[model samples]
Target: MMGFAVLLHVMAVVIWVGGMFFAYVVLRPVAAGQLEPPARLTLWAGVFGRFFPWVWACVGVVLATGLWMIFAVFGGMGGVGLYVHAMFGLGLLMMLIFFHVFFAPYGRLKRAVAAQDWQAGGKALAQIRMLVGINTLIGLLTIAVGAAGRYLVP
Candidate 1:
């Protein structure tokens, strides 16, 4: 059970963090270079609309498996080492940023897109990009902490 939970946790992080990297590093540049504003914005809206649901799933799995591992396998919060605790903290921070992005700017983006308010859509997209970038960095940091956490404990 613990091993399966760990697998789920790892997969969730991969999908969420890897997706962000693909978006930021690969897709964003190609889209910006190839597509005009209207097409680009539309593409982003559709992409995010599809992607956010997966992200939500990832968040759910991460939280569930993380808590399960900490408590069920590791004997609760007190037994978790500093590195795991740091990773947990970073993960929570990433989740909060994602929630803000989803509820706030993402809503605005969807509304602006629906209303054909290209300027507003563009503004909202920028905000989402900035927030995602922040989350991506945090996600990367969390991965690092998770990887090294076991060894770095003092």
Candidate 2:
């Protein structure tokens, strides 16, 4: 059970964080350079439409598995080191940011795309980009903390 939980947790992190890395680092520049505002906004809306659902799933699995590990493996938060705490804090922040992106900017982006409102879509995309960038950095940091924390935090 513990192993399964750990595997699910790691896989969820990979999906969420890796998706952000690809979108922010790889796709953003290409789309910006090759596409006009309309096409670009449309592309982003489509991309997010597909990716965000997976992110939602990842968030669920991550939270469930993380909490399971905390209570079952570590015997609750009290038994964990500072690194675990840090990872949890960062994860929560990332989740909150993602929720904001999905509910606020992503919604705007979709509506703008549907209405062919390039300016509004651009604004929404920009907001999403900024938030995703911040989340990506935090996610990377959380991964590192989760990986190396036991040795460093004790």
Off by over 4 Å in 1: none
User: What's the lDDT of the predicted structure labeled candidate 1?
Assistant: 0.92
Best by lDDT: 2
Q: Could you give candidate 1's per-residue lDDT for residues 41-70 as a string of tens digits?
A: 889999999999999999999999999999
The 0-to-1 C-alpha lDDT of every candidate, in the order given, reads 0.92, 0.95
Q: List the residue pairs that clash in candidate 1.
A: none
lDDT of 1 at 87: 89
Question: Model 1 clash tally?
Answer: 0
Q: Per model, state how many residue pairs clash.
A: 0, 0
Error of 2 at 63 (Å): 0.4
Q: What is the lDDT of residue 2 in candidate 2?
A: 92
Q: What is candidate 2's lDDT per residue for 1-154, written digit by digit as tens? A: 9989989999999999999999999999999999999999999999999999999999999999999999999999999899999999999999999999999999999999999999999999999999999999999999999989999878
